[model samples]
Target: MARTVRDANPDSRTARARLEPRGKPYFRNLEPGLHLGYRKAAKGAGKWVARHCTGEQAYEVETLATADDFSDPDGLAILSFRQAQERARERMVQRAHAAAGKTSPLTVRDALETYLDFLDANRKSGLDARHRAGAFIYPPLGEIEKLTTAKLDKWLTGLAKAPPRIRSKAGAEQRYRVIADDHELFRQQ
Candidate 1:
């Protein structure tokens, strides 16, 4: 397995404590224009952020998650140093995809269908994939060019956190229900 080299300062909590709190984040350049940032506050643990240079002087910035300095990492809202860096890179890639989507006229639904067609021709599990995608991915995703990371995250989190469905046989028909779960009403989501 390949091992990743850790950064010196931001990768360590002890090293971070030596730095002062400020509005601007301490940045480590991942590439020519992409940077991962740690923004420390005076009262609590810092947040992980990412910066992407768009043009000559323009840049895009986004806060990723809370640093796992005072608490254990959760891999979601709270992130370890390495996790933060990985999330930063993922966000940058998503941004690039969104930018590319601006010129493409295809919607997400169209892409999914096209992929399904390809899978059906090339793979044996295409029917299963089509059913699963239709049940899960195809509904909420509409005629949009690109889905934001936040939307995708929320949709996946909702699926993970949703309560188990309760199935009951009534007369000759079988029905699935979520007991006291808010997602019961929006099962297609």
Candidate 2:
């Protein structure tokens, strides 16, 4: 495994200014196949770039943002060393997903929101399902891909153990203790 080393040469404006401008960019290896680069221009501000190895002999390059050389970093147009590194990682991940013919991975919240939108568009009466998912499932689940069968089983068990809340005509709330005989109700839920 190749370890990432810290270098101050490409990190600061003054340090970068001391180096002679050239066609090649100064690179910092983030990992075995990933590199963050600072392409210093002959005049004006330098730009941040990211390089990712796609194959044994193939590499892909992307320009990320402007380096914090002449002005303070705005995080959008200009970036500091750390910020540039983060942006490079994000860009590489996006590229990797695209190369694999996949969209960006969706979080649990995103999936739920999408489903709710679908329900609304179809004019389906899914208000209860939406409420239950938002209040219970949304709080517990994170990324859908990270969830395992065991975790889902545990969550279902917890849901079954909790008392059911009932509302009265007077707009009052009541909690009824969960009973073993009420398995049918939980199963339906």
Candidate 3:
């Protein structure tokens, strides 16, 4: 004999309606600058619907719970997650432009000064000593404010004659070529 399966509730059907309370929820408890309403599915699942204002076009979001949930501590914490993502995206775009050598229309001297400031903030512990030695090896071509490619070439020539003194392990004078061939490549650019 075959057995027949019976419906758990033949009359059951999904219900749909606006889930927000009759009046507007308090402004302080809602996402600032935007109003959203919480909706509940027939199965009691929750979602969020954002609108420019009450009785305006609403955008449905599957993740957020009801307006009551917004009043809870955990809901407030979750709301900040979207805000934080927006801030991070803005910062990343700024950093990408800086890294691409796309500086503002600032003068070269001004750009160099800004770069120096960045170096100072992130300098290594021994950077000052290294810079002092490097300065002796490659003296400034002119007042950094009046620098030109020709003046820079003249300064490099001076280094070729008497490179900065490099001390040996025994503290003896050791002469080493400080000007690399590639030095001219940078000057040309």
Identify the leading candidate in terms of lDDT: 1
lDDT of 3 at 166: 59
List, residue by residue over 1-189, the lDDT tens digit for candidate 3. Answer: 899963221111121133333333212113432433334444443344443322345532223333232333244333333432333344344544576675553344455555566777787634664455345532453125456788668767876777556555544555664655696874864
lDDT of all predictions = 0.82, 0.81, 0.42
Of 1 and 3, the candidate ahead on lDDT is 1
Model 3: CA > 4 A from native: 1-114, 123-130, 137-139, 142-144, 167-189
- Model 2 pairs whose backbones collide: none
Error of 2 at 14 (Å): 1.5
Off by over 4 Å in 2: 1-8, 107-189
Indicate the TM-score of model 3.
Answer: 0.24
Each model's TM-score, in the order given? Answer: 0.50, 0.58, 0.24
Candidate 1: count the clashes: 0
lDDT of 1 by residue, 1-189 (tens): 999986538888888887789999998998877898999899799999999999887988899999987999999999998999889887777777788664446788878887889999999988998877866687777566778998899889987876654554544443445454367657755
* Sort by lDDT, top down from the best: 1, 2, 3
- Residue range with the least summed lDDT across 10 consecutive positions in model 1: 165-174
